[model samples]
Target: MDLFEKAAILQYRHRRIGDPGRCVGWCSTDSQRLRFDVLCRVGDTSDSQTLATSVSTMCPSSSTKRAGAMVIFHAPDLCRPACCTPFFQMDYVLASGVLSYRCRNALYPYKAIRQMWEAATRGPGFNLLAANVFEASHVLCGQNQHAILAFSRTLDPAAELVTGSVTDDFTLLMRRRAA
Candidate 1:
């Protein structure tokens, strides 16, 4: 099938699942909250200057913005350029970077990976947290499969995977390296 056909089928499947197009990879609201808590803790936003990538619903940009924090709030369907574009207009002096989730790439493919590299400086790295279930247990599972493959194809080419850990969720702290 072509891209449009694939998109239509995916939309149909989302409608049948009774989910908004943005709700990809999450099984429930509770699980989503749990993941958010983990991400916030891991990313460590105590310093007001810290920059982060967070789920728009889970982490309101307003709260961060109020505190003079720069956060890239990601929704799979909306804000595609913020999530996918390889460059930001300003020079972001990178600190040891924050964590990111790959579920956001379900629709945009590996653009997130490329964007992260472009956003960070040379030494300090960023974390990539992703989990993919291969079988299509439901419509969202197919999106997960797409995410898994996108990571496989794009991650190694973009950054050096410095350290990794896997449980129910997998996290990889990747450093910016010469391409």
Candidate 2:
């Protein structure tokens, strides 16, 4: 189908599933996903690209901005494996790099990020390292300061916790709802 068709379908799904169109997405493949079309950033790591998609200070805290600890979401053309590993790290740096957060490809138990901003001295990128061997289930990204959802046996997003995977349904939460 064409982009318009995909967009129409996405908007339909977003409204049905309860996600706002203001939600942006970025990936390294044509399947990154949005209510519109998919845009991938594979090789061109240009400064403009980084600036246009940086979520570093969308809802910034004083500490984060001061530290320049931007959580950049980088999605290559690879699908995240199932979120069942007790101890795993989505390393971004070559020798030893760890994402400020711990999440592989969000497509699995969570959803992927649409864009990012990185410093030159920081090297390539970051990784999503995680270790919860004691927990009996997999943890999903809940998109808030308390962004974690545990699943004991099923990865079904529709099961009380999730409406669907971030990749498929686009029911992702970049921020939390206020009380």
lDDT of each: 0.37, 0.24
Q: lDDT tens digits, residues 50-92, model 1?
A: 3344322343323334445454444333222242344543222
Worst 10 residues of 2 by lDDT: 91-100
Number of residue pairs clashing in candidate 2, backbone atoms closer than 3 angstroms, sequence gap of 3 or more or interchain: 6
For model 2, residues 1-179, the per-residue Cα lDDT tens digits are 23453354345334434233332222322322221111111112323212112211122224333444333443322222211122323211111011122234433323322121112111222122222211111221223211323321122232122232223222212211123
In TM-score terms, which candidate is top?
1
Q: How far is candidate 2 from the true structure (C-alpha RMSD, Å)?
A: 16.1
Which residue pairs of candidate 1 clash?
Answer: none
Please identify model 2 stretches exceeding 4 Å from their true place.
1-6, 9-57, 73-148, 152-179
Q: How close is candidate 1 to the true structure, as a TM-score?
A: 0.44
lDDT of 1 at 140: 24
